[model samples]
Target: MRIVVARCQVDYAGRLTAHLPMATRVIMVKADGSVLVHSDGGSYKPLNWMSPPCTLREGATDDGQVEWTVTSTASGKGPGDTLRILLEEVHSDSRHELGVDPGLQKDGVEKHLQALLADHPATLADGLTLVRREFPTAIGPVDLMCRDAAGASVAVEIKRRGEIDGVEQLTRYLELLNRDPALTRLGPVRGIFAAQEIKPQARVLATDRGIACAVVDYDALRGIDDVEDRLF
Candidate 1:
């Protein structure tokens, strides 16, 4: 990861035009070749960003200022959405060698819930059985691919604390999955947003989308798994 604090001007050309005038801000170049321009505030979300599968070219601007050009290909913000940054004055530029992280290692929040749900999917809904976990999709992996007793496909998104964003993610997955002729052959694939606690607004949004919102019982699910193991 490379972090640079510089007084820079940024211009993005894509579906829309966005510009950040010359000001001191942080530019984050992630390992995946994505670049984000962040101001000091705005929480964690970047002011402007280009996702991975992009390329970065460094050169000098007309005025001899350092310039970074980032271009993204075919991840569908159109064929190319370009971010051009002109660094007028770099306050501090530091490159840190953060050796490949093994990824998130939390026990109780998102991942743990995903694992437990995958192991015991019926807990999400009666008669629901797991087809697979990390189900492949062009966009990314679905947390759980399942089928109800009637054999209709179900795409389940599991989150520790369900919010509007989680529902939005599941909605996109369903949109993709339903387009697959093979999956749709059985029946229309549906979506379930499963989480430990879902916000009220999220529930309303999910219900509106025809996606079911399920509240997970962490301890009860663990107990059910233990009991099923004992029975075997």
Candidate 2:
């Protein structure tokens, strides 16, 4: 996957001034040729990062609106195929901050998940229960397992941090769960690639393969105290 960051000058204080009003946006393009826009609340106009072999052309301003044309990388053929387009806005700094390190984000997400499971056991979806299981596998045991309620069989494999080949990892786990005669009786086995954010291609591949997947955000697990800290 390729990520591009673009910033626009919405308001300028002065050419020599140290402070300026700038709005930034991020766009992500996946290996499977899908695009996702990360919005920054509601500050700037939507922007997209064109995929490889494509170029963006800016048009004349009209009625206070900006337009751009996307041309193909091919030899003067025409505009390339539009795979995906998304609009995003920049949120105010008072509400949120940008450039959060990936490691920190993953840690925060894991902490929030732990807090949620501890606080709301009943909120877990059907056929899924939290378990602290030890595995004798080559890679080593996992911290938690989401298993089928009745058979106590591991249906989905989970990792707290780091990025793996999620699609392939989940597919292997689902196959193992389904292949087990004891687990097969429980019904069709599936997998969940739970994380802070599910990549665009991963989401599409998981859906196409009949595997259940979810992109869980930490916002859902924030407590009243957390909310208070953010507000104040």
Candidate 3:
């Protein structure tokens, strides 16, 4: 990962147009060539970003100031998408090579739920078959992805306690996944927010957004002894 703190102006042109006027912000260039521009706040969400599989070109402007151009590798026409950063001054630039991440360690409840669900994905819904775990997306990975008997794609988000935020997160993942070209062909992708307990309001919100809320039984699922079946 490479981090640069610089006074810059950013302009993005793609599905939409956005501009970040002159300010000192953090520019992150991940190992996969994804670029993110961040201000002092807004949690983990960046002000603007160009996802991986893109090209970055570095050069100077007419005034001899630094400039960086990032273009997307999407399937659209000339320059799928673009992020242009014009730098007035660069404060710091550092690079750290993080080979590969081992991934996250889920909480106790979430861990058992995911494991049991992965082993028995049909428990979520009838005719559901496990496709893969931790399916990747542009923003992050979904907890699990499965397919129904009709061949439609189902993105599952597992939470120990399903709150409104969990529902919102699942909504975002479903939105991103539906746009993926590779997954789009598999039919419409839907979301299922599964948790040991779901807030009533969260269920309403999820239903309003066309996302299904499933109350999972972590302990009951864990009780399913796979060893007992073959031992006989």
> TM-score of each candidate?
0.52, 0.40, 0.52
Pairing residues by index, what is the TM-score of model 3? 0.52
- Which regions of candidate 3 fall more than 4 Å away from where they truly are? 77-80, 109-195, 198-232
Model 3 per-residue lDDT tens digits across residues 1-232: 9999999999999778999999999999998889999999999999999987899999988889889999988666357489999999899999998887999876547767888898998989999999999888888989999998888899999998999999999999988888877777867799899998999999999999999888886656767445446656
Q: Whole-model lDDT for model 3 versus the true structure?
A: 0.89
| Best candidate, TM-score | 1
Q: How far off is residue 12 in model 3, in Å?
A: 0.7
- Candidate 2, residues 96-207: lDDT per residue as tens digits? 3334446634446555565565354323446567554433333443323556656544434333432447667667666655666755565665555556566677778877
List of clashing residue pairs for candidate 1: none
Q: Which candidate do you rate higher for TM-score, 1 or 2?
A: 1
What is each predicted model's overall lDDT from 0 to 1? 0.90, 0.48, 0.89
Count clashing residue pairs per candidate: 0, 3, 0
Compared with the true structure, what per-residue lDDT tens digits does model 1 show for residues 142-189?
999999999989999999999999899999999999999988888999
TM-score between candidate 1 and the true structure = 0.52
Poorest lDDT segment (10 consecutive residues) of candidate 1: 223-232
RMSD of every candidate to native, in Å, equals 10.8, 14.7, 14.1
Name the candidate that leads on lDDT.
1
- Which parts of model 2 have CA positions greater than 4 angstroms off? 1-106, 109-127, 133-144, 147-154, 157-164, 222-232
